[model samples]
Target: MSSPIALHTIQYNTQDIDNDTLILLYKNLLKPRLIEEKMLVLLRQGKISKWFSGIGQEAISVGVTMAMNMDEYILPMHRNLGVFTTREIPLSRLFAQWQGKASGFTKGRDRSFHFGTQEFKIIGMISHLGPQLGVADGIALASNLKNKNQVTAVFSGEGGTSEGDFHEALNVASVWQLPVLFCIENNGYGLSTPTNEQYRCEHIADKGIGYGMESHIIDGNNILEVFTRVTAIADSMRQSPRPILLEFKTFRMRGHEEASGTKYIPQELMDTWASKDPVINFQTFLKDQGVLNESLEIAIKEDIISEINTHLKIAFDEDDIVPDKTNELNDVYKSFEYQEIEKKPETNQLRLIDAISDGLKQSMERHHDLVIMGQDIAEYGGAFKITEGFVKQFGKERVRNTPICESAIVEVAMGLSIAGMKSVVEMQFADFVSSGFNPIVNYLAKSHYRWGQQADVVIRMPCGAGVGAGPFHSQTNEAWFTKTPGLKVVYPAFPYDAKGLLATAINDPNPVLFFEHKGLYRSIRQEVPIDYYTLPFGKASVLRKGDDVTIISYGAAVHWALETLDNNLDIQADVIDLRTLQPLDTETIYTSVKKTGRAIILQEDSLFGGIGSDISALIMEHCFEYLDAPVKRVASLETPIPFLKQLEEQYLPKNTFESELKSLLEY
Candidate 1:
């Protein structure tokens, strides 16, 4: 690494730091208070809802985060109320958010002042505390990928250090050597629990040592100290990717949440903390240095208050950015609160591969905003060559190659989307998605519910097994994400459907998980539309119909079902291919079961806790009466996928479909 730099805990008695320079720094530090007061005042008048104050913690936040570029990024917790002003977040929009008005930042879809942004890299807040830090690591990783001079400044509470996610993000950041500055605001409490109870370690700064990082313990209220440490760390980060730990010894001075206060705080301890208040201490330190006086301090406060109020006025007075005017369905397949009848094409023409490739070409040709990211996809056009020749047609920026950090890749895609770009991220192997599970479940899936309308990226994982992916590469894992409500999960078996579902997912406002089966990538080839088009989300297709045993499946298993029923005279099995796992096609299942009186559920995922389980449960709830006999399920045996092809063949569900169907039919 670079030469080790030591941060002094001793007094800085070095070269003279000019009085004028210090004053300017102090002015920047105090400027945020103007907005802080304005917001709190509005909250009291019921002009807004509630606030988690940064009233006494301004010096540390302003000093550290302002040292960063706004176009860079930050994942702030509740105490980031101070950085909001430096971020130039419109106060009127904040008020609108507080009042739950249509003019709010998220168009009344989010709470006061905590929401995502399209124009700025400033992320919306996360309610679960440590989850936001995971995103911070992602943003920094994205910066590394894009070759940009930016660092992600993540703020969290001392209490958050106890969460497994906090450690996970830190470990991944260290492993990837990401450019991230972690600021742990030691407000002496972790919610109702105090620091003394939460940890017995010396300090959070020491925690970085385990990750081979340098850390500092700064006076949280001392703007000068904060600025020096944070800037130096940020500068070094840009030079090379490395994690830095910063422990800002600040105090809460208020309750954890808006409605909650620190009544549990003893009056004597509160008085002691008030005496050490960062805002007041920094102001006093400035006066002692002869850099601050009564008149000058008053003037600075007035000017800042004026500046803050002006922005607040603009946000409050300005009109809202209306949501989609058409008020369409939640996703492409399902119109906003409306359903469309999807009739099968009269002709059985295009293979699924051609359809998928054609869809990519049409969509990219139509929208200048769409970008494709994956490994080897640029040169090799992916393992299946679905994206072949696209890089030559569209430049590298639109079809970018990526390093192999799965979680970090997802993080970057999510960040770019949050910044108003439409990004598509690919997991080369579906099993590798385990690497990015943290971002998917904790950040991307929950960002909107935590703040508002934060879904920005669409993730594509090539999933399912048929041609011997064994366990690692072939398993169908759609059910892992289907139960998660916010994300849209699509698994199509044909070319036309893949193109349509992918187009819909790309345009949908929320994050989408498109699971393309590796086995079907080449097997399902067909003539795709030469022009651009979008297929609706939440729609299913019935490929073949019969009044016998009904087989319901998606992705590779659908094709397997088609083959299972192919030329079988004794078994007239109806086939239903559910393109969407999230909004399961219960109607199709019920209709088929009522007509056939026997049913078989099939997927390539593990037999335990997979999509088949979900479908079986639904049938019990809605289609139990139609069952002429017991329902049967076909899925992979419960075991980790083995590398040996023969063992994998036995473990997988492909060979079981025919036999399972026979059992259901005979029952």
Candidate 2:
């Protein structure tokens, strides 16, 4: 016969918690269980769409939530419904949220625990369980900076431990010594994959040893043990801020979701875990201790059922407000009216890099809540020395040097934004952005639309070719972000525009991708204002004016068009530089195209799926009647950026743009 499973219980005295608090914890535990049971019935009746049942793991959620203070933040997953209830979130609103009603937390945009409310200090988990760990680090970072002495608790499953984000978050948290309680609910499986197949480590707590973080194993099924252990750990962390990993050994009694059954789980394992159901075991323990009797248990059960019914009626009584196209379209981005700063006549001849650094310095002076985070940005001054004396001027608290962790740092920036602070994340190279793409597209881009939460963050991408840095280092990847709905993509050609546009991006109440062409950072020089100023987005700058033909471009491609026009004096054309790609200046393009009667869009990205493709389509759709000839697009070859100068020169459109422009002019 197999040995029986070991169970952990309260090792310390329980006298610290009074009788009333103990009973309150019990009530909190019972709330999610009863509510989940009722939700299952609703699901069966087709009243609800789907459900992720936390039927067996109520103790860990309730105990951890009860242990944390009201001011402290808790980021919980779908299996942690008890966290919401224990925090006193309105059950009616939660029901409305599940029903996709406008009165719910996400206002019908997202379902279940995918939304967060700042008022309750509870951050909802995204479908990706691991990113929340990084987000917790961000919140705790804010706490550390503000001297709040607050501890943040973030939860995940054993399955999430396999993700790179899990390791990055833990490493960064430990490196910064942030006060975070990483609670891992070891429910023995991730979806259908068993623990044996998931990891070779003996226990999840062993992962913490590599990170040099303190860890503990807990009986997740025991409410009293979870409560007492977490309480002690949180208290210690607040006094001496650091991260601790707590592995709550438990099991998932239901499938990953309602549709996926538990058939994959062995019958013996299921039978073993069924005997240790958190709700039933805790209730039995409470009864055995004389804290509850038959009459009290019956009364509590009746009251919970009545409460669930009352909330259900309120939720059902509110008419299901389906999301409309108009509202859905309008809510994609939050508008922050650009406040123009007083213009100063003082000017300095500076390079594009200098102008960017000056603009960042001025903005940091104006906004106290603004922070800069990137690898080697502080002491080492970043890859291109953009942040070179910022550490001394702004202090290490505001200008943080993160580890070589692009994914976690980006999510950390979002966390800072969630705390009502502005953050600037400098990508060492534009190609490195692929590591942090998930948070930018999924979390930051969808934040406002999903929950009316603006991500006041900026990601500075140093991009472009011509330095012979090869494919990885030199890539015009601006097209990747232009297609994303919530992101504002900005690319400047000159020093003056670089400074003004960067200032605007930092203050905008939305996520912005600021691309700086490294080729022009030092090569381009102009007189830029030393004082703070803002430039309006979705506005095109006409560098030169002519009536023969219109040449439209941005970034380094703009300069190439201007040079081509200057050289070929016979070919008079209006050169338009699109400063921002997301909020595109279509009006300027249309007006210029109508006047010139011809247009050629130029870009450094490959020919296929470039931003130029969309511009070409728009011109055809809107300016078809005004065009004298077919709209042309001049772009790089449909291949990776070449390494050799001769091949690269041939690959990019700069050398070929003049020919394309002449062809369009002739037609």
Error of 1 at 363 (Å): 3.0
Which ten-residue region of model 2 has the weakest summed lDDT?
Answer: 1-10
1-667 in candidate 2: lDDT tens per residue?
1122343232323557776777798799989988998998899999888899888799899999999999899999999999999999999989999998878988787888999888888899889778888989988998998899999999999999999999999999999999999999999989999998989999999999999999999999888889998998999999999999999999998999989999999999988777777666666666666777879888988998998899999999998786588888888999778877755899999999999999898889989999999989998999999999999999999999999999999888888888778899999999999999998998999989998888889999999999988999999899999999999999999999989999999989899999999999999899988788989899999988999988999999999998898899998788999999989999999999999899999999998999999999999999999999999999999889988999989889998888888888788
lDDT of each: 0.72, 0.90
Which numbered prediction scores highest in TM-score against the true structure?
Answer: 2
Each prediction's total of clashing residue pairs, residues at least 3 apart in sequence or on different chains, is 18, 0
The residue-by-residue lDDT of candidate 1 on 1-667, one tens digit each, is 0111232222332135587767766676666565666766777777666788776678777887767876788777666766666676666555566656565655555574467664555676556666667667656765765778788888888988997667766776786687889899998877789888988888999889887877889888777778776777788889987888899987777787657888988899876666665555566666766678989988987777776677567666766545663532232222233223343444345666667677677768866767787777898898778889999999776787766667656766666665456678878888888877877876677666544545667788877655666667866677778877567788888787788777777777677888887777777666555555667765678888888888888887777788777746667778888888876767777888888888888877788788788788778777788888887888878887775778878877778778778777777
Off by over 4 Å in 2: 1-13
